[model samples]
Target: MSGRFAPYGWSLVLHAVVVALLGVSLHAPAPRPQPAAAQAEAEPIQARAVDEAQVQAEVQRLRDEARRQQQQEEARRQQLRDEAQRAREVRQREEQRAAEVKRRAEEEQRQRAAAEQERKAKEAAEQKRLADLQKAAEEAEKKRIAEEKKARELEARRKQEEEARKKAAAEADLKAKMAEAQRQMEAEAQKRAQERARQNATLVQQYIADIRNKVERNWLRPATARPGMTCTVLVQQLPTGDVVNVRITRGSGDAVFDRSVEIAVHKATPLPPPPVPELWEREIEFIFEAR
Candidate 1:
């Protein structure tokens, strides 16, 4: 029995030492001891139980914070994706706007070029029309000049022909007038010659009167005498008679002169001019002188 009791005591002592060491290590910052008065005021709790409850609460708080952080990271990622999509849309819209502007510029250039070509073509047509009109006017002027020249030539020829006809008519009229004047002069000369022959017959009668006056100078017969004496004589013969009688028709009016005149007459029987055969008696009377 002693030996058993001794072993048991030693075991107890060892166990006690182990329990004290575990308690100190397990609860390093132990709860402070309550005052004697306070100890009686409330029921005492196990230190280990309080400690286990505090540790469980801390662990749960940590898990809740980690879950919140994971939710924030996911939200940020979704926002970044949305921003990138919007940027892509903006870039495509800007490219389309630039293309539209370029197309409008090209269309305007084409319109301006077409308008310029129309203007130039209109100017060219106007110039050609004016040139054609001017050419027509010049041709008309040339035709007028040619007609005038031909008219002048025709007029000159007509004038020349008229002058030639007039000259020929004047020359013929002059020749006819000259022939009429020459005929008139010849007729006048022939009339004058006939008048002169009548005058010559009167001279023969004067010669015979002078012979009868001289033969009756002494005979005073019944005859007439002026201061400038005048006389007449007659002679006759029968068909078979040899002698003819002489008679005086004019004398100085002396009776004795008549006898002397008879003797003188007998001396000059048959006077200077013989008697005409057609007249049996030839008689002559004369004006002895002119006053």
Candidate 2:
């Protein structure tokens, strides 16, 4: 039993030595290839053994640096996103303002168009009203002219009829005068003389009455004149019935009243003609009395 245990112990010692060598190799750095010329010129280089604890500390520092870099990249990405969002908002605000400006401009244009249209419409309406008034005026003028022409024609016709009637009356009077002349020739000379005197007297009375009527028509009585006031006025006239002079033959005591009557007689100039030419006088005396 002792002999079998001794052989087992030797095998264990050899395995233990092999395990230690494997552990050292696992921890060692990989060898780098050197140039042949450098290896020949230099002395034998001794390799420094690696420290496991220091290597572990360096690996941990690298991991920490990598983590910090990742965090910085994330922060940068977030900042870029925020800037993009702000830019998008600014663009939206600008678009809204532009839309508002365009809407206001369009509204102003519409208002101006409406105002212009209304002005034109008013002008057209005014023109139409004026045209209507002018048309009515023209129609009224035409009617007035036509009526005046008709009235003139009627007046001319009436004048013609009046002239014709006067001519016919003159012819009848001429025939009667001729018959009377024949009768006068057959009468005695003394009877004819008496008849002529009577006719002369009648003519004188009628002529005096006509003069009185004309003077009375033109007379303007003075306030001083009384009802019983009377005066005689002497008047001188021409063959054409025009008054040449007027004189007061008698006054009614009031000089102003007498002067007024004299003026009235002169104003009634061109005294009525006598029926008989022989009855006409250059100077005649007439009485003025208030009615």
Best by lDDT, which number? Answer: 2
lDDT of each: 0.54, 0.75
Tens-digit per-residue lDDT, 1-291, candidate 1: 454245445544555654565566577875568798867644544554565455445434444444444454446446656766777777777777777777777777777777777777877787777877788888888888888888888787777777777776676666666666666655665556455434444444444554555455534443332344443445453443222675656654543444455555556544444233332234433322211
Evaluate model 2: give its TM-score.
0.34
Deviating ranges (above 4 Å) for candidate 2? 1-81, 154-291
Alpha carbon lDDT at 147, candidate 1: 84
CA shift of 192, model 1, Å: 12
- Per-model TM against the reference: 0.30, 0.34
**Which ranges in model 1 have alpha carbons more than 4 Å from their true place?**
1-104, 162-291
For this target, which candidate reaches the highest TM-score against the unseen true structure? 2
Which residue pairs clash within candidate 1? Answer: 218-257, 219-257, 219-258, 220-254, 220-257, 220-258
**Model 2 poorest ten-residue lDDT run:** 45-54
